[model samples]
Target: MDFVLVHGTTQSPAGWDRVAKLLTAAGHRAIAVDLLTPRDLPVEGYAQHARDQYDGERPVVVAHSGSGVLLPAIAEALDARALVWVAAYIPDFAGGRSLRDEASAVLEPDWIGVDPTADPAKASEFLFHDCDPETERPALDSLRLFNPAVLAAHPAGAAPEVPSTVIVPTRDRTLRPDWLRRAGRERLGVTPIEIDAGHCPHLSRPAELAAILTGRA
Candidate 1:
């Protein structure tokens, strides 16, 4: 299957390198979109941008971290065959809250309006703690500031009706697993598939994550 991997906030397309490579080795095409450029898009705009990255059969759209908010619209734009969320936020369709509000308690205090780049130490501690030393370095170096406009805008539209899978990193420090579980149940109405890794499982557990994404796990 073809896959479109969407990285989260303050992250670059390079973050998906490990997982994308694994998928490609297994004979699947993968596209990791560069969502940071023209860093002025809202949720819908990002969805369209991701859609434009590929032209082929409906791909399985995978979302990581903050990129989760883009999935609903992306599914529509791409007419996605399936949606895979890896430790991602499943937006509350109630339309009253923003992604920042959903992540406020878990995110660092200075996550917004202060610095666009992620602190190296914090990224090590929270996002890449479970990754290999080599994997963690590139992941950290690839971090970039996200579109602040995305944080403030509430995800519009209901969750897409495509087949969906939600994977919760059991050891996540950035977004607690308990909250991930609850969000998966409450927002997406699916029991999350748990994995033993931190926030960036694609780096720490690429083969395992790849298996799950491809339904081998």
Candidate 2:
């Protein structure tokens, strides 16, 4: 399947380096797009660009973290065959709340210090707990800073009928695992595959994560 990999907040297309390489090595075509700034533009205008620009048939829409909000629209617009979510916020039709609202409401971390904005210190401190110094170290250096103004803006929810699979990180500080699992059922009405990892399992445990994605697990 043609894979359209999307990075989460404060993350660029570069975040998918290891996973993309593995996909290529295995002969699966995987393309990672910058969720923070696609087409050198803001996230608000993503629905338009993806519709007109994407070139593929039955593309598997793989979205991570905050980027999950826009997948239903992209899939609807681009006519995607399936959506593969990796520790993403795959909410139902009435998507719980905006990322900004959700962050402000929760008490996650001091480094997270606040909502959805990029903070390398916080990332290293919170999100990458399972990852090693080598794994978290580089990601810290290249942390993608989103347009805070855009993040604070209201979030449009994903479509209800879009076919999707949610991959839950059982222990995530960035997003509650229980919350994601509930959303996967309540919103998507689908049972999710729960994994014991942090936010981005594709980085920390690529073999298992990929096996789950490729369905050899």
- Write down the worst ten-residue block by lDDT for model 1: 107-116
**Highest TM-score model number:** 1
Candidate 1 regions exceeding 4 Å error are 105-118
Cα lDDT of model 1 by residue, 159-206, tens digit:
678778889998887666787788778777888899999888988899
- Model 2 alpha-carbon drift over 4 Å, by segment: 38-44, 51-53, 95-97, 104-112, 115-119, 147-152, 155-160
Predicted model with the maximum lDDT: 1
The Cα RMSD of model 1 versus the native structure comes to 2.4
TM for candidate 1 is: 0.90
Report every candidate's CA lDDT: 0.78, 0.68
Candidate 2, residues 1-217, lDDT tens digits: the string is 6677777776767778887778777777777765443434444477556655567766777877776767776676667778887877654347546666666433245535443335555676566778888888766654676544544444656464646788988877777778777777777778998888888787777777777766621
Error of 1 at 46 (Å): 1.5
